[model samples]
Target: MQIGNWKSTPELGPLYRQIREMGLERNIAELDAFGFTVLEPGVAAPMEWVRRLRDRLLDVAHERTGVPHDLEGGAHGQLNTQPHFKHQYILYYLLLEDPIFQQAVCNPHLLALQTYMLGFNCRLSSCTSFVKWRDEEGYGPTLGLHADTPVAHPIPVGKDTHTGNSAFLLTDYTLANGALAMVPGSHRHARQPGRGEGVDAAIPIEAPMGSLVVWNGNMWHGAFPRSEEGLRLVLTMYFNRAYLYPQEDYRRNVTQAILDANPKRLAVLLGLADANMWDSADGPDFRGAFDVLRAAQEEAGLPTTANPYEAQPDETDVQVAAG
Candidate 1:
């Protein structure tokens, strides 16, 4: 999609308008220059808020894996323990289980970055935690340096990279902790990197805790081996252009209570609503999504108008929080 502004409708509500404009121009510049950018700690949320999110995720990791854990020792988790997962343990559908998760994924600045990179009608394809355990028994740190989108739509010979991700560090991302390693500007590489080329040439991303690292999914990137003594946790929300189907049906996973309680701006991100999503909108029973949007008005009961996934401009003072 061309880099431009998307208009907002009443159904988008006031919050969407504000997020639509947050740090837009600067973020676009960063994305164009390097295919990624790092928003400082607290840009997406307060330090205390993110700290709590980390604790909750760790709690879930231990419970789910039956692994004894402590911050000092880190928790044990991997594909063997989680048979259906890859890399580290994946905690899916966290959006419905906890309020803090909802707050993290729908963070205003994060939303703005997603819009600027993936387009206005972007779909939050995945909300998962890639937990790197330090000293987990038999755990290996190395992973392939690869692109998330190369499988579905191989990067055209001369096209800009597509698909993107927002990885919020609950703990600091540093070389000592197996931070994400990448070759700057590698997203524009002619094609996928040879196995050893990308991995050998990559550099670790060292940023403070709470930093939100945004990157094109096609970038040559992977995690560094964990050498630290604690957990290296990051919550990543991967986004795709509006047209592509999400890996998990976010719409079906959430409950009526969550829908009624959440802000309307998240309705689209959560797949509770979308302006142009017609994959399931063929019949009069525009499915449960349309009905959810209709019922997603402000608490005062004003009729929600228009379900367009587009965003509009504003002057909300998008702060990067100075990493």
Candidate 2:
């Protein structure tokens, strides 16, 4: 009798409820069942904004590498350097390159899904681009689909998602356009696939421009060879739990102006709220920790007052060495 009486009804968390409000319950269900989900155009952001992102990505690519890519024929043909594969260009650290990229990460629907997959305190690991063109050699799948999180086998189950990945389609994604190939339900495997393993089950994720495709970090995924005659543009945003190290040093490198321009949530996503990393002479900043708590409360629709440490510390003086 006591056991039956004490079991309280299960309820969705505030973040989960937020996701439902944004009409992403199905997307959440897909992630839970299939390890991946695609949010259609206009769901994540406006088509006009997506188009602007595409244009800016191309501009950054040209400015960084001095390559006026032939957009029609897919003749960009690799950046004359070895990337993880051929006929593709990997643009790293796009967040610092432009304000549009900053806006891209703060998208409400996108962030809601990101929070749902990772956690309320998840930190952005990286913001980059994948500019791919047709491969003359007829691109083959990588040796095997790979997991984004580098962890030991039998990756922990449940909500402790160590990492998560989202790819924003700047151009139409189709099997013919070398879209992402993912193994359905592979996240439950909790282990990386061996070479040539899981290939038979992999399917290309097709979505229109402006769509956002997200997946569990433990899922096995790779891209198909581009057969079409135009560029397949993508802006990828990677995320990790607060404890794990981020791919980009946003905490140390994020400028004050950038933080000022965006919402308070941006500071939280950039790892400014994480108080664990303390190399300062004055020791840990408790203010950031409170900021994090305030943010969580606000997102939960709880009443909260402005934080005393509303102005984040100036990190412009901090210098990080390049690889």
Candidate 3:
């Protein structure tokens, strides 16, 4: 089927209008040059909403692990039993945990950046949280710097980011509080970092609570060791291009009621608008593909009703197709 016209550059596309409308032109430029950008507090989400998100995450953590957490202090129970990585309590599939997470996934600023990185067909990969504190054996000596798209050998390095990460700071991020460590422009390297490699180049990303730090999928990143006395809370909302498999099975796991509660765009992000493998004789629905295309345009601030799939070919084109 025919497809709609897509602008060659981000600045020339509808997505750029959304970015410009949100005053994120600089952040977009940073992502191009440095492979990452930080959206300060009051830009990503409201401070009150960020606090509520933090509280809800902590409550859910307590419910699952049966350990009350103090964001300003510390917790006693170890939520993660795996010895391979014990520095933080990991909360997975947070989209299923609360409505607040759903709201977070729809954050306009985040959607703008994610759409820019992964395109309009971008779907959510995972929604998780990392609750870190000072470990008895220390947080980390090795930075564990690596690219998110490690599945590819000699990963393609360029402007296209197959995967992207938006980390929402629930608590104040400081060097002492174990802020994320990233190597600037490492996405251009086109390959994963070797063991203990890029340590000297890694720099801590410090920001206030409610801020959002986003990066390219190819960027090499890790975290600094926590020396402070409290928990460092961060909500990680990961995204991937439509062709990539998501870390969580959101398409299969998301309930109809959940889809109904959120905006239509949320359903698109959950992979509902795209056609999937058909098990029945009916086969895949072609409308879903057009719906996804329209949704992409809508999110990019373009006209949603103009579906190229429905456009009829002229007589010359018809004769060409017949030939």
Best by lDDT: 3
- Candidate numbers sorted by TM-score from highest down: 3, 2, 1
Candidate 2 segments whose C-alpha is farther than 4 A from its true place: 1-12, 77-84, 136-144, 158-160, 292-323
Kindly give the stretch of ten consecutive residues in candidate 1 with the minimal lDDT sum. 309-318
Off by over 4 Å in 3: 1-12, 80-84, 136-139, 292-296, 305-323
For model 1, the stretches where C-alpha displacement exceeds 4 angstroms are 1-24, 77-87, 135-143, 150-153, 156-161, 274-323
TM agreement with the true structure for every prediction: 0.75, 0.85, 0.87
- For model 1, how does the per-residue alpha-carbon lDDT over 1-323 read when each residue is reduced to its tens digit? 23333354342334344444464556656766776788888776889998998888877777766775565676466535343433356666566658888887777687766765665446778888776665332123334576666344346635454577878898877787878887778878736676566655778889998898988767777777777686778788888776677766777667767756666656666665553444454532333455555554443143454543223323223232453
List model 2 lDDT by residue over 1-323, tens digit each: 11121224121355666676788889989988989999999988899999999989888888877777666666463454345756677888889889999999888888888887776678889998888888644346452478888677677655346888998998888888888999999888877788877888999899999999999998999888877798999999999888788888877888989888876778888887766768978777666666765775575564454565555555323233352
Error of 1 at 265 (Å): 2.8
Error of 1 at 200 (Å): 3.6
lDDT of each: 0.66, 0.79, 0.80
Residue 323's lDDT within candidate 3 is 59
The true-versus-predicted C-alpha distance at residue 306 of model 2, in Å, is 14
Per-residue lDDT for 49 in model 1?
92
